[model samples]
Target: MTDYVSTTPGLYPLPDWAKDDLSDLKGHQKHDLISGDESEEITAAYEEAREEVIGVQQDADLDRIVEGQLRWDDMLAHPLAVHDAVETRGIVRYYDNNNFYREPVVQDDLGFSGDVANELEAAAELLEADDDLQAVLPGPYSLADLATDEQYGDEAEFLGAIADFLEGEVDAFPEHETLFLLEPSLVESAPEDGLDERASEAIDQVAGATDADVVVQPYWGALEEKVYAHLLDADIDAVGFDFVAEQDDNLYNIQEYGATDDVSLGLADGQNTLVEDPEAIRDRVEWVYDQLPVAEFETVYLTTNTETFYLPSGKFEAKLEILAEAAALAEVKAA
Candidate 1:
């Protein structure tokens, strides 16, 4: 028997009004860098949006809930970008997509400042049980690969340093059921000849940081055989595969390398505007489950192939609704 879970892997889509408020806030920051001007209206708007998103997840009857990551202005680079030891460099295209983010430029040794931990805690306050919360963060490899490193000149050394920085962040994290490490860079820019092990070591560093179950997901496409093989060696509880962009490679890797007790199936197309039928999503889950080498799965998560931040809020909502319904169907069949 396999347990089923449902969650969005990255920043949930923001309401149109919240986006306007955020844009205005950014304009204010750009106009006057010295002023520590905080917008109460924007804060209120964020709080409202957060509450609404939580309500949506609850309405969908999801097994696990993410804080929606609505506070993320820089996506993966926000925590590092806001740190005193780092600076925001020019924008970089995000993984061949129509999106962009300000890359974090690390100038000194980094430490956790509870940036995301605070966000997670806020979500915790609204939930009935603390155990239902799940947190999402950029995996160590993606953060280091996407950023501009000024301090550590060595490649491997910088890789390990990012791991240590993330460890510090999760070391300060509040109690939760799971943590999702988004590592789209692994699929977009595959590791070199011998660096796969180093990347895995870096990932395992953060995986060992907290008590929560860790899931490292690579999206934007499927991973190569060697990359997938090395990733399975990591100490994390599960590895998620993108079934939307590149399904065959992902399916092949699972068949050849086997899988952990738990696995994440990215059945929804996050970037697309169309919403999948709930039955279709459920069928895909069962199909993937049947291909698993193991007799039973400890857990199988229903997720988007990648982040849904680019999709419209209405469509994103519909997708989650579909995802939850699909998960319900899968659970019933598994039972």
Candidate 2:
């Protein structure tokens, strides 16, 4: 088993109180709000938000800690959207959610300047248990799915370019125990006929760039059968299911195809504000074990179906506490 972890998908909602102060934090780096005067204040806001998010992980007794990605705009497009090689196009729906993100229009060859790696380093500086660190990024297939691809006109070429771009970023990621490649498009907008292999290969290309165990977590729903099979074929260390949104399909897929030795179960509802009872969460975990033949899995992570940023900060923090309490009740070693 790589490790036991209780982690959110990593795009956390900025607390209501901090929203105004930190809303422009990402803008500073994007040069959208490049007032050199706010440089000290920007650094102060990021540090305070990092401490708030990481402190909650500590309070929940989570084994893995994230930087909360407080400065990220969205998972898939932020890296590309902010790149000099890409343009921020009009806003588009994020998967099937009510939320939206600016579409990234690629116009040149992909490049990386250590954006995520820098965030991971900032997060590491605030952590005492160094190995407990984890990082998150949007996976390649989804990044391609969610963006406009004029640079690489061909489908496979576009996917490969995005993968190559992410691979470069992964190579620069600070040392961490786990890396989550969020690939909601795999479930939301299934790949076209016979393209599952291309998608899987593109994913593995980026996963290969990192030493950290990679968990390719697809959410909003479950992947189609072939997509799920191909995803399992990738060089991933684990996979996460949106048990809240597509429990039947996800459960059926696991029973049919089995699973990697490390699995993440998205038992909590990421889109809702109401917190679930820890006992109910534990019951869900035990129920899976009773229903499936997955006892061989080295670690079973308890996480949300999608990123928790959709919820209010207080509700998000409550969800974190629920995860830890439930993991403890289930006696899962990692939480």
Candidate 3:
């Protein structure tokens, strides 16, 4: 039987404790926290929030646990914005979503700031001894696409520099079970114009920087063959495809590509407000599995297509519960 592990793409809904004064704190207070001016009240509130979310995931019996990314105030651009070499530019739409992120402008050579590593370490302290912890970060190509480049005028040069910069950041990450490199730009824009090969080389640099298993999760939708096949060149452990948003295309891609050593099948829709019943979710997973080249993969991960931050707090737990139950059901059915 395949090891059908359940996990998330990180950036969970903001905990309730941090939501009370959100309107008042939207501008200045948020800046204060991001700039390292957090107050005692804010610190305590986040701690409680983290613990609560962590407890929820633990209770759901998820195989891999994330840090909840409560401090990722700027979404995928947060890590870059906080880097000493990058500057926070004007707000820009995050991919096709209604959400926005402060575009990080590369002003100088990039380097690791140790922020994510510290956050992961704190999360490790809160987990049980036997729990398997995982860390998530934006992939190099995606970060480059999100940021404005001033230091490096050329795209190829900028991409190479960004890869090296992300390598340093990954080096700082604490030892974990897996490192999920979220690469939305790769699929969202579809590099059918021959940019896919260059992206493959850059992706290899970032993934090779880490010793932990690296899973490239392109969340928006299915990738074209040019981009998807290039992923085979990258030295990553698993490739995640979103079956929720692009089930038809994803299934087609999987069948065409045959399969891989491991696959992370995104079943839950994090963007939608409607929560799914566990039985329905189980059936969906089973349907996807029926089409999958199961013999080609040793393990499969059940997860949401994107980050859960888009979800309302009240619906987050239900989604996770559904995911957990579906994972168990899928495993049983496969057995």
Q: Pick the candidate with the highest lDDT.
A: 1
Worst 10 residues of 2 by lDDT: 28-37
Order of models, best TM-score first: 1, 3, 2
**Comparing candidate 1 with candidate 2, which one achieves the higher lDDT?**
1
Residue 283 in model 2: lDDT: 89
lDDT scores of the candidates, listed in order: 0.83, 0.82, 0.81
lDDT of 2 by residue, 166-247 (tens): 9999899888888889999898889987788999999999989988888989998888988999888988889998889888
Full-model lDDT, candidate 2: 0.82
Q: lDDT score, residue 284, model 2?
A: 88
Task: Give the worst 10-residue stretch by lDDT in candidate 1.
Answer: 29-38
Candidate 3 regions exceeding 4 Å error are 21-33, 294-296
Candidate 3 least-lDDT 10 residues = 23-32
| TM-score of candidate 3 versus the correct structure, residues matched by position | 0.93
lDDT of 3 by residue, 270-316 (tens): 88889888778778767887787765467777888999998988788
lDDT by residue (163-195, candidate 1, tens digit) is 998899898888889999999989888899788
Cα RMSD to the true fold for all candidates: 2.3, 3.1, 2.0
TM-score per model over all chains: 0.94, 0.92, 0.93
